[model samples]
Target: MAEVKLFGAWGSPYCCRIEVALKLKGVEYEFIDEDVHNKKSPSLLKYNPVHKKVPVLVHNGKPICESLVILEYIDETWEEGPSLLPKDPYERAMVRFWTKFLDEKCMPAMRKACLSRGEEQERAKEESTELLKFLEGTVSGKKFFGGDNIGMVDIVANFISYWFIIGQELVGLQVLTKEKFPKLGEWMDEYLNTIIIKENLPPKDKLTAMFQARFEAAATATATAAAAGGGGGGGGAPK
Candidate 1:
């Protein structure tokens, strides 16, 4: 038997990606829930000293950090299950390109749309919508990014189907809507409905509650910063 363990935070979409991959591969792993937001665990620190982040996969005493890296490792290590990525080199490269676009381009813009206010929020919303439009075209006439089944792109984009939806709802920011991007919307519905994905998802209510708290904290921080900036404009002289 192989010794497989995973260190992850419950609410993180990045961590959830790894969990979903492991499940898809039918790999039984011991999940060590770590408080990534509050305090770091000794084991987590030891395994991922540089990043000190969650979603670290330890297989046979060797640690693999980063969700995307861990996902490829899971797929490669377990050959019995359905392929997470394509075997063709060019096809695999395309998958990596889109995943990178999602994480680097789409996600940040969507997050900013939710966290920023006024002009910045509008810009972020526009950017996110444009990025999503590209994805809409990519997924057009397809049930999934993998053509008919879940694949690397679908797994990497897990955040869009769930986390981003909940976050945009909490902030009342609508960068992604079925009316605006129907193809991507349909893809989301299909991805979320898959038995494996549906079974593995964290409870929606719990995820929403967590997002609400984070949004409140961000609002408080922004207000405090604004107040401090206003107070500091005294021209270094007492009038």
Candidate 2:
């Protein structure tokens, strides 16, 4: 077996994707947790100079960056457990298509709702809800994206298992509803219910606290900016 090592931030679902893949494959490796926000380590920079982000997988002394790419690498490298991807070329293509859609299309709206406020947040909430319905279409008639078992799509969509809660809470809006998206909502339950997935997930309370911190900081910055703008606009007038 090739020596494997993972460098990642515990709270990041992207990191968790690769982690779950390795576990499901029954691969053994070392794990290193980076101080995601406050400290930037030299090793993180050296391994992923371009992105300098978490979830970099090092296989046999070579580093693989990007969550999806690393997922494919691990799947292809190990031949145990269920395949991360489908063997059928058409199904594989479909899996890849939806995964890309989640990253490129769904993620942006989700991020906008999570990080932005006011009109932008509301707009993102609307976009996110529609995008989620589209995602539900992808689920179709399967227990998971890989049909009976969890696969690449399940790993890639791992964010929805947990982070979706934080996003909705942050924006104070409802996008994913059981009535509107029964399939996808059930998929979320199935994904989380999977044993390895449930065990490996970051603590929900910590994740929520982290997001709440972001919201509070953004609010403070907006308030400070408004105060500065008001003071600057009014100070030139003589009493």
Error of 2 at 48 (Å): 1.0
Please estimate how well model 1 matches the true structure, expressed as its whole-model Cα lDDT. Answer: 0.85
Please give the lDDT score at residue 217 for candidate 2. 69
* Count: clashes, candidate 2: 0
- Model 1: lDDT of residue 95: 92
User: For model 2, what is the C-alpha lDDT against the true structure?
Assistant: 0.81
lDDT of 1 by residue, 1-239 (tens): 89999998888888889888988888999999998877999999999999998889999999999888888888889997789999999999999999999988988887777776777778888998889989999999999997987999999899888988988888887778999999999999999999999988889999888777777766676677678883211011000
Best candidate (score: TM-score): 1
Error of 2 at 47 (Å): 1.1
RMSD values, in order shown: 5.9, 6.5
Clashing pairs in 1: none
Deviation (Å) of 79 in candidate 1:
0.5
TM-score each candidate: 0.95, 0.91
